[model samples]
Each structure stands twice: as structure tokens, then as C-alpha cells.
Target: MTDGNPDSDGLVVAAFGNRGRLETAEGETLPYLLKGRRLKAVCGDRVQWKQPPQSHEALITDILSRENALQRFDPKGRVEIIAANLTQLMVVLAPTPEPDLFLADRFLCAATLMDCNPVVVCNKTDLQHNDALRAALDEYRQLGYVVVQTCAEPGGNVADLTSLLTGHTSMLVGQSGVGKSSLINALVGDAAAAVGALSDASAEGKHTTSATIMHRLADGTRLIDSPGVREFVPNISASSEVQLGFPEIVALADRCRFANCQHLREPDCAVKQATADGDLSPRRYASYKRMKNITASGSV
Candidate 1:
């Protein structure tokens, strides 16, 4: 059989070399080699490659354009691109399993810094619910983000969540045991990821030992299942940009007494006043203070 034109483009990624590779859009993961001279590739990178008929292998030639990329600092302090061309980030949190506010804030800030729409997903709602949590989440909904509540075990609200992901490439980020894998199974209707039960000792879900991978949902959209994260340090482009990430803070910054108020121990700070008057979410303001301290440390 004649080979397809090598110029016909394909998505190129680096995977465990021993794992079966991906060559085409058929959803079958296949193995391929980086034929070019020492080029590093990441997930969601588009490239042109050709599969050799003689063997079950392929070769990558070039990387195409990237609309936007999500990156973070690695342990070596190098910026690593986690995903490319993501239109949205589905930040998952489960209340029945217990709430993890720090993890949620980290994911939200990272998504905002990376310029992707951050949507909140509260899973396992059937087990437990809190009015305060709902009201706090509404703050995000009012900011124009789509928020959805889901119960993964009984398939509650999974269909509505699926509809929101249709036709967009999204990344799922949250802490371990947030029903991320369970929700993935519910949405895709397949056990693509192993499901673990919550721990008896700490009421936290066990981690699934698997590599991060991307899968296309039946709705014609791509979803990347990233490994759950425990910590996220914000990489603000500028010290001033930190205010921009906090919606309420940005609104109140202009009214501060000083043009460059840090909002901590500063006289006549509008943000501090707003926090006192209940205009800003106390928890959100606390998170902002923690982040501001981190930024002030010059560690970023």
C-alpha cells in the first residue's frame, strides 16, 4: 500500500517509550520516535510525522503552531509546558469527600495566569453538601465561569457536565481524591482511569498510579487527564498582575490610599477595608494574602 504523504500533520507527544504509540486520530495510542535532531516535544503539540510501513513505529518531523500553552516551573526552575492549545481548565473539587480549598485556589490561580477559562466542578454532591460552599462557589459563577455539580457514583449531573465540555480542549486539575478519575469514567462512560475508594483513616481518596494522558470525549472535544497536584506556586508575570487574578481585589485596588498599596499593614488600604466589610470573601482574601506574601518573598 502506498504511504500517506509525510507532510500530512499529526499530534506529536512524548510518552513512555515502551508504551504502545499513537500515530493517527483513530484514538489508538501508538509508539513513535523523534527523528529530528534532539527536539523536545510536549503533550498537545501538533507536528508532521509518518509511519513506516515496515515497522510499528513513526517519526516526527516538525512542530506546528500553538495557540496558547500552559506552563509551570519544574523543580530545576525551568518552565515546563504541561499542555498546549487548551481552551479551558476544568478544576474539580468534591464536597462529599471533604473540601480542599487550598488546592482549588491554586488551580484557579494557575488557570487564570495561564490565560485559560477556569470552570469549577464540585463532584460527589450526593454524599454531602454545604450552603456556604455553594454560596462561595457562586462568586465564581457570577464572574462568568460555568460551574457544575456532579455525583459521579450515581451518574448525577454528568450529562450536563459533558455538554459544557463539548467542542473544547480542556484540562482537569485538582487535588488527589477529588473524584477526577471517577468523573472521567462517568463522562466518557469507560473506565479509562482506575477508580480508588476513599481512605478510611483520613477520608481522602487514594491516588491512581498512571501516566497523564489525553482522551477525546464522545462530544467531539478533547480532555486531558492530568495527575492531581498537591501544591501550585503562582508565577505572576509582574507583581502588579497578582491583583488582576483576584477579581474583587482588582476592583478595590483603585480606591486604595496609595497608588501602589501592598494591602498588608498599609494605612487606608481599600482591600483591607473590603475584607472587613464583607465585600470580599474572607477565605479568598486569605488566599490572596498568602499569595501576596509568597510573591513578596521574591522566590517566584
Candidate 2:
């Protein structure tokens, strides 16, 4: 176990802690213990630590500087940091529980707002055929976003995913049972995350990832596997911001009826005209409307 002192010189973080072996840097697992009240350290936080005179375990001292962090309302409605210094967000989804487009869009929108590159990953490709899924993925690719497909069972197509993640600090996020654990295991080259089965009756996943963890890959890549978010309610996006999330929507918003027209209910709304002309997907329009109303309600 570790003891935090003012003289320590290493970072403090726990991955799969069990009062015993915990994953650390360079594939080194160590023993750790929580310190004082103000010493709250989550995954991906850099800290200072030092080993005792006669002991093998090291004690953490101070947390170093963080580039940027992602905050969200916890279950108690209190703000909490999910991950720190994430350069990218990997939004994973599978077809078993069905791909929730709304969830994916919200995650992608948040990542864009935070200046983090968002990569869409669809796992469990071996279970289903790819005609419709490929079509959906094509739209994102056309938008200039990188999308990858993986199977994660024995041998899957994770090479594309790994290539994108190399040498960058990224966070893997999605709903449970989307093969997130499987993908993490593949990326890190081990069973770093625990895999759980989806509920047979409800087709929903049993949550396996209990906390956020930073895993370093062989190619010097760093990734944070956060707890699977079942429901992603994108916070802090205004009407204009929502439009900005959909690049195509913003591209055609200037020709709308009014400069301030939300493109929902306006006399000469260009967005509405385009939708009528079938230039935009009805489903995407519907998603925008939902976000617009949610923002207008003043409740993120």
C-alpha cells in the first residue's frame, strides 16, 4: 500500500484496485491507498510519488498540471471530472442492443465542442451482416470522420482502430456490451478490462467497467476507458451549437428565413425547405429538433 507524503515523487492512480495488484505505468502493477480528503485523483491524472526507505511501494505527493478535463453531472447531479487530458474520444457502439444514433451524436457533439477528435467505432461485426451498417457508417466517413468496425472475438479487425489511437491520449466511451471491454483488451493486448454479457431478456448490457482507467498501449498510445454511459444527455449545447454539431445543417442555415431562425418554425426557413426537398435525412432533422427543444427548455 502507498502513503501520500509531501516528499513523494510519482503519480497516484488506481486501476482495477483490489487492495492488492493495480495496473500502473510500463505494465507495472502496484499497491495503493487513498490519502487525505483533498487528494482526490481520478484516472489519467499525473502526480508525484516516491518509494519509502525500506519499502517497495511508493507514496504519491502532488498532482501535476492537466491540459483539459471533461466534466459531467454525476448521478447525484453534482459535477465530476470523467477523464483528464483526453485528446480524443472513441464512441463505440454495437448492433446487439441496437445502435443508438442519438447517443452517438450527443457524444460526438460533446467531443467536438471540447476540441477533441471523435472516432466512431462499431464493434461485434462478426455477429451480424453489414449491408445497412455499412451504409450508416458511410455517412460519417463522408463527413470526414474516421469510423472503424471490429469483431473482438478471437481475431477481429482492430488494426484500423489501433492505427488511429497510436501516440495519442484518447478515451473510449459508449453504452455497455458494445464490445468496449473487448476493444480495450485488443488495443492494450490483454484482458485489462472485464467483459460482461448482455442481458438476454432485455438485450441490455451488464455494466462491467466500474471506473475510469488509463491504459498505455505498446505503440506509446494512452487511452482512458471510462464507465459505459447508458444515457448521454449532451450538456451546454445551445441552438446554434446544436446546428454546429451537424456540419451540413450549419452549412445551409444561412439561407434560412431569418438570421435568428432556428430552422424549426420559420416562414422562409431554408433548412425546412431543404428537408422538404429531401436534401437532409428526416431522422437527422428529428434529432436536431429534439436537441433544439431540450436547449430551449433551458435544462441541459
Instruction: List TM-scores for all candidates, in order.
Output: 0.82, 0.78
Residue-level lDDT tens digits of model 2 in 154-216: 777888888888778888898876877778787777544332321123335444666676667
Candidate 1 lDDT tens digits, 132-219? 6787688778756678888888637787688888888787777767877777777766545322321123334445524455666666
Best by TM-score: 1
Residue 114 displacement in candidate 2 (angstroms): 0.9
CA lDDT for candidate 2:
0.69
Ten contiguous residues minimizing lDDT sum, candidate 2: 194-203
What candidate 1 gets wrong by more than 4 Å, as runs, is 1-5, 12-28, 130-132, 142-144, 190-209, 258-260, 295-300
Q: Note the Cα lDDT for every prediction shown.
A: 0.69, 0.69
Clashes (backbone N, CA, C under 3 Å), per candidate, total: 4, 4
Candidate 1 global CA lDDT score: 0.69
